[model samples]
Target: MVEGRPVGRVGDVDWLLTGSGDPVTVFAHGFGGGISDTRPLGSGVDGTRVFLSFRGHGGSGPLPPDWTYDTLADDVRQVADLHGATRAVGASLGAGALTRLVADEPERFERLVLFLPAVLDEPRPAEARGRFVALADALDADDEDRLASVVALEVPAEFSGSAAARTYVRQRTVALRAPGMREALRRLPALTAVPSADALRALRAPTSVIGCVGDPLHPASVAEALADAVPNAILHVYPQPGVLWNQRGDLRRRISEFLNSR
Candidate 1:
């Protein structure tokens, strides 16, 4: 069991390497999230973990004006290729990135975990997009109070106003400090993860699609659809969106068992 290490940059991506053995797992945090957001989720899982922050998210470089899904996927692709990751885990924005990458390069990873998937082929709902826009607006205004409030709204009622939720919100707010992230947030709303579900059928890796009941942003339907499309995907739908907040131990165990089993 290796402790965490300092973050290093490869091109535009900020990557943190932890553990040190076979079955390397690359973790891509959600949009407006950093490595701290996802690192603890897989803490109980063994093997080397390469945690990466997409551009303008986790100490990574600022986003290019025209950045899109391809840029995000390429960020994950870059870290995975460089680290020789045997498995990968993605949450929301990161899950979208993995979907695009694996669709084109099916054999890139041996195992996969798509947790809290936000979208697939179709564009997300306007309400979801609106939420992102609101977040960006708050961030752009540099309103810490508003940003924290907006972030807190994303937390499920199961963990609403809890100490853990506060910390989680802080992480998201702190991550938004990355340069030029407001544009990244505004641009992402209109983009679908991949071209089509037909593209995902090409995926060769066994996948674990995890979702929850009430998250409008990362809807459970998307996770179900992803699991249905992937030839060999296991579905895990937690009762609440705050699975990471209240059910963390269970979530970590599931992630550990799945990644270790491969």
Candidate 2:
């Protein structure tokens, strides 16, 4: 079962630490997502894995009144330091937090994984901000159906009618109905993860950047740009957006291989 007891706060942020051994792998989930959402990729990996949710995210504390990607990186740093982790993994918004963390401290981590990164050095277009804003509005209104509708826009069209998609959207909608969720979605989409490409160029860790074609929310171009900008980064482009469903084994094996590389 995927569960964790509240073992108190780390760096004023709540998180769950699991596994054992050296080379601990810390996980940061996307916005409005719980650690369970990231466990699929981190499972069976070498060494220990610790998952940290941002101040307002996952099951963490209430969202701070004033915080950005850089501020959130402090939370990541605290968790990694406490565990003596040499590797870290992030998805979407978490990817943003990690990028900010590494940009400021290039050698903070020995290895890094950015899965389905949503943004890089710049803020996405105005149109791209609509979904998140819509979500925030829906959440403020306490409209579950509206929240589901906004999530549906993020899922691939081909899978929209499937049972898995319904369950996925439902789970997301429920998880997002938290105290500070609306405020987060409202402020985040407008913020940039890092100031410029120079932020990526300073990275000194061996990194893996993974993305897929069909996910408009997390574009492949952003992933490609991150790979190009980082000095020692490798890129992986999955053929479809539903990589967790279609490329599960391949991805699991790839993460293991990359994390275990000599």
Winner by TM-score: 1
Model 2 is weakest, by summed lDDT over 10 consecutive residues, at: 1-10
lDDT per residue for candidate 2 within 1-262, as digits (tens), equals 2485444468667677777787799888888886787777787688788887778765567767677888778889998888898999998888988988998999989999988888887787566687778888898888878888888886777778899989889888877887777777878777878888687787879999999986767888889988898999999999888777678888878887898887
Off by over 4 Å in 1: 1-3, 140-142
lDDT of 1 by residue, 46-165 (tens): 889999988887567887899878898999989988988979999999999999889888988899999899999998988799888888989878899998888888887767777978
Per-candidate TM equals 0.93, 0.92
> What's the alpha carbon RMSD for model 2?
1.9
Q: How does candidate 2 score on lDDT?
A: 0.82
